[model samples]
Target: MSAAHVISILSSKKARTMTESSQAMEQWADKLEAVARRQDTQAFEALFNHFAPLIKAFALSSGLQRQGDHLPDELVQDVMLAIWRKAASYDRRKAAASTWIFTIARNQRIDTLRRLSKYQNDISADEIWDLEGDTELFGEIRQSRVQTQVRDQLKELPVDQRQVMAKVFLEDKSHQEVASEMGLPLGTVKSRVRLAMKKLKLSLEALDL
Candidate 1:
């Protein structure tokens, strides 16, 4: 075929893919609406079948798999239960069903992490800092002073970087969790956290001088 014909064929394929994706989303929305309106078990079952595996994978990718084999399964169950309970609140005009479901999964994952972290009694000042390197300067100061200095430096960071840093260090979210929540790539989230840490280190060192 001619080059123009190949380009035309590719464009048609792309259009078909977009159309198929939209149709799938619409079907999911319809199922969710059915559950909301009637408490339809079959509709909910369909949604569960479709989204459960996806939720499990999302939890695993966020490092929950390493936490325990059962945690990912528990997270998936929690997300699906939230969907069933909150189905009445779903607004298709505001978000697609998949978006709403995955958002619940992300939030559920964060909450799970927080609950797990609470059991750890050994978290030190350095662990709270969460920075990659050991800055001797931070070790010399009281944790309270370090916290104040870090908070001040955090304010000076660019908003994008600062938000990622807050999620990772303050909220105790994994980088993958932040990436999923913020709809950014994993590498992008990690880079933002690294950049934020470097800035924090320099600012704190200057304050110590």
Candidate 2:
């Protein structure tokens, strides 16, 4: 064959390969959208089978593992559940299907971590009343204001400190436990918890004033 003809043939073959790849990707995206719009179990199962191992690897690499080999599986389940619930909200224009699913998985991991941090910190109602410093005695309205202020202040806290606070108070974890789980020094964990508490208290105290 002439060199010119051979080059043209190779170029045509490359074009066909590219086209096939593009079509395959489009079909995958369409399947994801179908699951979102119709809650199609088969479509979801296909996606889960394809992406679960990848998501699990991501979770493990990111240090989200449980002691047993269950964290990756659990994390995949959580991601899939979020995808199921939020399928209708998916917007193809804003993000590709794979990108959207990955984002959901990432957010679920963060939520799982925060949930672990908030599992069991016990505080009594009497202590709460004292913390509000007779504000409730003034009126229900005053108590509501204090509650709102506390929530707002908590939201305003830096993410690192907030995580520490959640683990220490809500999860009922000791600072050592928080340190161990987070892979930080015990003093660092204590410092974060103390700083978070101080900032929250100051914000609430200012609101009370």
Candidate 3:
């Protein structure tokens, strides 16, 4: 075949692929909308059949398998439940059905991690700020002074680091929870928290407290 003819064939294939993709997206959206508009179990079942395997793969890739073989199943259940309950909130214009559903899966994974971490040796705010060293000195006067100093130091941190520190320490959220809520990768959230803590530690040391 001539090069131009071959190029035309490739272009036709690409267009067909795009059209098929758009149709598939629209079909998913229609199914989800049916479930939303009415308690359509069949439509919901269709969604489940389409999304469950994909979600399972995502869960395994996200390290859920390390926790337990059953955890991925649990995550899938949670994501589907959220879809059922929150179907009415979905807007196709804002996100495709797959995008919306996977976001829920991601958040559910974070929540699962938070639940699992609770049973582990989770760090406390006092530990993060090194207040465990001097029990006597951590009394009311010293506690108040340290709190004021820490607040001041927190204000000096970069915005991203400060937000992560606030969510993880002040709000008592797990790193995974902070990551999901902030729309950041888990690693980025952890790195920000670590950087924030390091800065706080340096500031506290300079204060000799």
Report the C-alpha displacement of residue 20, candidate 2, in angstroms.
Answer: 2.8
Q: Please give the lDDT score for candidate 3.
A: 0.72
Window of ten residues with lowest summed lDDT in model 1: 126-135
lDDT of 3 by residue, 148-205 (tens): 4564577789998987776675343689988888899999998887788777664434
Which of the predicted structures, 1 or 2, would earn the higher lDDT when compared with the native? 1
TM-score of each: 0.56, 0.50, 0.56
Between the candidate structures 1 and 2, which one is better when assessed by TM-score? 1
lDDT by residue (127-206, candidate 1, tens digit) is 34322223344342343344345645767899999878867854447899889999999999988888887877634345
lDDT of 2 by residue, 55-163 (tens): 7876775566654477778988988887778777665444445656766766666565655664644542323322223322325344334434555588789999987
> The CA-based lDDT of model 2 is what?
0.68
How far residue 139's Cα lies from its native spot in candidate 2, in Å, is 53
What ranking of all candidate models by lDDT puts the best one first? 1, 3, 2
The predicted structure with the larger lDDT, 1 or 3, is 1
* Model 2 spans > 4 angstroms off: 1-6, 66-68, 117-209
